[model samples]
Target chain A: MPYTSDKPPLPETPEQLRVRIPGWGVDLDPADRPAVPRERFDPGATGAHWEFPERQPEERPRERSIEHGTLPPVFGTTLPLRGVSGVVRRYAYRRFSEARAAHWLLLMAGDRIDVVESRVLAAVRGRPDDPVAETGVRSEVSHHGWSSRAGAGRADVVHQPMDPVIVAGPWVLGGLAAVVVARRLARRARRR
Target chain B: MRAMVYRGPYRVRVEEKPPPRIEHPNDAIVRVELAAICGSDLHLYHGLMPDTRVGTTFGHEFIGVVEQVGPSVERVQVGDRVMVPFNVYCGSCYYCARGLYANCHNVNPNATAVGGIYGYSHTCGGYDGGQAELVRVPFADVGPAPIPDWMDAEDAVLLTDAVATGYFGAQLGDIVEGDVVVVFGAGPVGLAAAQSAWLMGAGRVIVVDHLEYRLAKARELAHAETYNFAEHRDVVVLLKRVTDHLGADVAIDAVGAEADGSLLQHVTAAKLKLQGGSPVALNWAIDSVRKGGTVSVVGAYGPIFSAVKFGDAVNKGLTLRMNQCHVKRQWPRLFEHVRNGYLRPRDIVTHRFPLEDIAEAYHVFSAKLDGCIKPLVVPGPA
Candidate 1:
């Protein structure tokens, strides 16, 4: 690819940044919104939407090698969706996975941790309307978002919406810290 | 006088430009006699052409007189009236031998994988266009052919691009005898393709375009059955209804970015109006073709990669073919056709303007004003 010298102009202020890199469709005014508390982080929040994607039964699993990585689950000629989201969100966390012929890892991220968790939950809860598609959990992390390290094996995700956001970490801690500071300032203004 | 050079998207300048000198040993300088504004030329003006460096003159199609020739160039003498093939290619490349002159490696390395042409982009060897008063033709001995004594400069200009491309489209589409052909897009290329298809023995040549004037031109000048895509929403149904539901054997996309709005700033619409979203005639062509039919796309598309549902293509088993017209392969044959009176490529030249009034010409072409098909630009006698 040729080097791109043209870049769209960037936002200068935090308000502008928030408007641009919005997490989980959450509005900038978080005070009126339902916040996902840090303590409520659940690895199993994936619900019933989480199911191993239908794999072709005819193919045999490969033997593992220590030098390279673990062997992949070989399947018959069926091509599965790479991205399929959970049942509840229907098309939210588009989740689709296919067994790999080579080493690979599944990486997932949201604009923020809350958004990531919501996507994970959506992936777990298979869309009731379409039972054929389901999302499976390989691993979960709050701030790190979700990742499944299938030793040297590849997995493709379908319906995976790529959000343009450069987040530092989870939104819960950041939101809670801001809330505390705002309350203190309110108290000071009341005293004045 | 400064020559217009493309700086960036929508950016062009005519500064105190240096005189174009003969750069290579085989290069010959020709004072351009008649250079025309081509639809392909718009790709550069819009800054959509990738990697177009600054200081490149931006016209390709030309009819010129040989002012000077290199020591080794014995093919044409000075004052010889010639029409240079828009694409510059050495006569001795692998592709050139295979009659695929557009893909010549030495002239256009970037597009050599498929094929290359002139005044397009840097990937095509970064050769400056013929928009200026004088142009340097590299590989002069191989790239240019003399204009016949009977043919005028105005008539000869079309041989370089529109005529050649249209002829190529007809040949590539495999328009069989008595086959119904639908050419989508009514720009200069589309008009040329329609004429070529008619000449190549197609029983019916249906030209589809949204503009009424262009459709009128197709009917009046090219004698093609024209369809107003804007008024007629159902191209597939219409084609099927016209051809006993068998669709067309050959479908050519000559409109490219021009009539299809691919060259404009707007994203290509799924539907022309709000009726049903489909790529107008292209979709109809895809659906209207028989299972083993051929579809030739010579139109230029913009930056946005078009999303095509592959399922329809698979089921039809359609032989989709296209290439940037290899002027080297078809030019001689097309030139002969023109000479024989079988090909009337010059019929598409609806407007001509002086070099000083180029901006007005651009406005007309850009706005699709006054039934403009092909606008020829004469640089001198101002």
Candidate 2:
């Protein structure tokens, strides 16, 4: 997935994929594709000087999609893979082709995991994320939060009921856990 | 010839490279005089875009003297000082005929969405950019226009992309007279959008950004109200309060890919690559606009999924208009604006670097060092 030459093997053979998924290769036939006629395959027409442009030296490992034969000539080294989220991202790139939904879904999951990791790290550094302020809860009251949505017939109105729970569920759970721990510590202190 | 070569992300160097030659009948080779680094170029610099080859030179906004022309080329000749539009398109293409040169289907192999752009990734058609001594422009007759004798060279260079794109952003907003417009990201594009909003008869224009220096530049250059988003507890709420709790009549997103409002969004999209771009500014634009108002997006984003609050736009009945600016389409009006002294695109230029020192230039620009707003690249002797 990151800094490797060999192509990753697909989880399933093409034949297996074809049978497992319905209409998996629907656009494989040129006849079925409307734009096939206009899609010209002319490499020389681009007038590039080199067959394969010179590869940039990789100072560190970099992410490459499984679909690519090798890393692109240049890649970002700013954000290196790290932590549990990194492991999830690595698994996605290594195990799935970009064409697969799993690859993208895993990457999205990794992003969510990264948020948790960041929150934990921030908490450890004594700069815990403020859910009330960061989440824009204060804006709701001050900036016509309910009235704006009440009769507006918004598309997101369908999920408006769930937004608060989705936003504050984890924070509520964390607060409850802290309260329980504090109570337990108090009880033990009294017993001593 | 010397060109800026992408060694890797955050790594570029000025290297000796062969000068570009006309490959197509409509191609023209232009000796670059002035080129400006675009905010979008930072996408390539940070390796956010896919298929950005190492040796690719990243510049789209450039003006130069034509050195050679292909046999079939017309409307332009050698020795003419021309500013090439960032778009490379065949004039006769369906999109070009409709004045949508940015969507011209013939130039780029991946022509489902955008047309060819110089010095962008292979996804945009692997034509080298103008951040070099020379650049080969395809469909030269259609794209490059002679710079007016009275026009400043620096102004012409900025028009190639930045100014044009900004003007286009405001135009797309469809601003009505006395409309309040809020522009997110006070970079060159945002500044231009802010200024152009006034031209479009906007009553009030507010520019938003975290950087105090850029906010000051917005005030000085665009003559618009400025807000340091970092100072506000919630910029969107502040926008609502300032706009009389109805939100701005129009909101323009000039920040793309690497927007820095929400730490979570920046980490997820810009850092983690889970989404194509950080949608903070775009989301802010969508949120800060009044119900039934328009939102214009000129910020460059990758051709991938972004966690945009699309449902909010639909619910708010917002008109979301966006595209890569059809650069030439906006020029006729812009030229007049420049001539009338209503706009001065080059006022944003804060730094200039010779082709040899582009890496330092990029570093200074990318890191936002020295209050650098816009940096111009001089290919000739500096």
Candidate 3:
């Protein structure tokens, strides 16, 4: 089976959830009064007036297994490079270029591959345990935002929003240098 | 145009909703003529199915006159009367090729668990059903079959889900020439299954239900022995006693999650929604069948885990078979039966309500009121 369903439901607001999951049959307030008497029916009588299901709706057993989907957050970050005479710059360029190329390929393919550990896989598989239970993100983010997870007990699963300019600068410089190098080689070949 | 929108648990209202339009190339829009509130629809109405969103329409068993058709729709056309199978199966899939239309792989985005089911919440492909003025049918040619010229609209609609499911339940029992079959629940599906059991050559058939009206219907319609579980001190013990303590050769559970058994279990599971559903009828079916007997389950239940007697079933060496019925596969044989006067599928419909008054129809069916054995919905003036 696919780890997680590709189709996630539309976001259900609290307003909708309040009425739906409460398990109360619209008894809090009768939305509409029945024009016909709420009289019981006789098994043999064929003429019980039904004025459109104006009554409140209730839930029954759903045969299929569609549950609330919890998706791992997808966010991006950037890395800054400090280079003397573009030495480290060239090294960072190769590494970051690989990452950009991979990103481009996935975008072209119009699909995403989620690679997580078995623990995270449990949530995707719709099994009992979930990734959120393994890691408490809400409380961790509230106090320090991104720095708390980096503290003593946990040193992983940090969320730091990085400026895209850092990666964009080196990428642009590398592209310009490549273009210059290509032009010179082309000119030399033409002269030869 | 009005559709029965499910707002919350046990709360249904008819609201003006925009009719469906063709969203895919193989899709066809059917202006629903005759629809039925299926027993399984109660599951959605009660909020047992997960991800059953509000604004979801609930009828899966419906017949309609085709209003519009996408370019790729070939089998059904505009103005044609068609009875759509509850399953929205793509014809060319690994499962569909093997005639397992209910397990078709290429339809539902969530194909891992269930195939496409119309109006059956998001878990079953999230396809909208034919309960409204217009419904979009996917893979239209494969799923919707033309109504046999001589068939009644009521019979055709029932075949879309309940009748087909009941017959499939009997077929899964693998009934032999003289096998005794005990069917739990005398609802439309149970009645149909008991009747179908006879066609499958079962020598003796017994129908069990808590309702007097339904048990009486079973006695009259299927000509089978009837047992009122409400009357028996122990229904399972009584089944064993009546079957010479060997139990019946086959037992079919036609009652799904909402079945009543013990008060505590029913309160927690069916009422509280703690577990899937009170596994009362299913457990009884398991216990009532003979050792090494076949157990066929057609009753609809929530996908969540339930406290079932799996250990006992394994120890008894019983063969268990179940699925959402593959409706198209049973159509040919059912058509023959209907034509030959062997089965009057339409005779079960006890009440009919306009699409405008579906809430009352649902209430009548859900409450099992006024001997509403099977209630059919009239969508438009047809």
TM-score to native of every candidate shown: 0.62, 0.69, 0.67
- Candidate 2 on B128-180: residue-level lDDT in tens? 89899988887676789999999999999999999888988887887765677
Q: Please give the fraction of native interface contacts (Cα pairs under 8 Å between A and B) kept by each candidate.
A: 0.00, 0.00, 0.00
TM-score of 1: 0.62
Better of 1 and 2 by TM-score: 2
Tell me the tens digit of each residue's lDDT in model 1 across B85-148: 8877655544454455565544532222333455555434456677778877766777787888
The native-contact fraction of candidate 2 is 0.00
Candidate 3 DockQ, CA atoms: 0.01
Measured over all alpha carbons after superposition, the RMSD of each candidate to the real structure, in angstroms, is 26.3, 19.0, 22.9
Query: Per-residue CA lDDT of candidate 3, range B1-382, in tens?
Result: 7887665455566667777766556678888888888888888776666545555787899998888987666677799999999987766555665567787555554224567788886556666677787787776767787898999888899999998899888878877656788999888999988888776666578998877778888888887799877666799999987876778889999998878656666656655566667788889989988779999999987656678999879988999988888887778777877887667888898888777666666655655555568888787763
DockQ of each: 0.01, 0.02, 0.01
Better of 1 and 2 by lDDT: 2
Candidate 3 structure lDDT: 0.65
Question: On a 0 to 1 TM-score scale, where does candidate 3 land against the true structure?
Answer: 0.67
lDDT per residue (tens digit) for residues A1-192 in model 1 = 013433222223334422422121121122211111102223122111112211213233221222222221111111111222112111221232112211111111111122334345445866221111111011022111222222211111110121111111233567788899999999999999
Worst 10-residue lDDT window, candidate 2 chain A: A30-39
What candidate 2 gets wrong by more than 4 Å, as runs, is A1-192
Off by over 4 Å in 3: A1-192
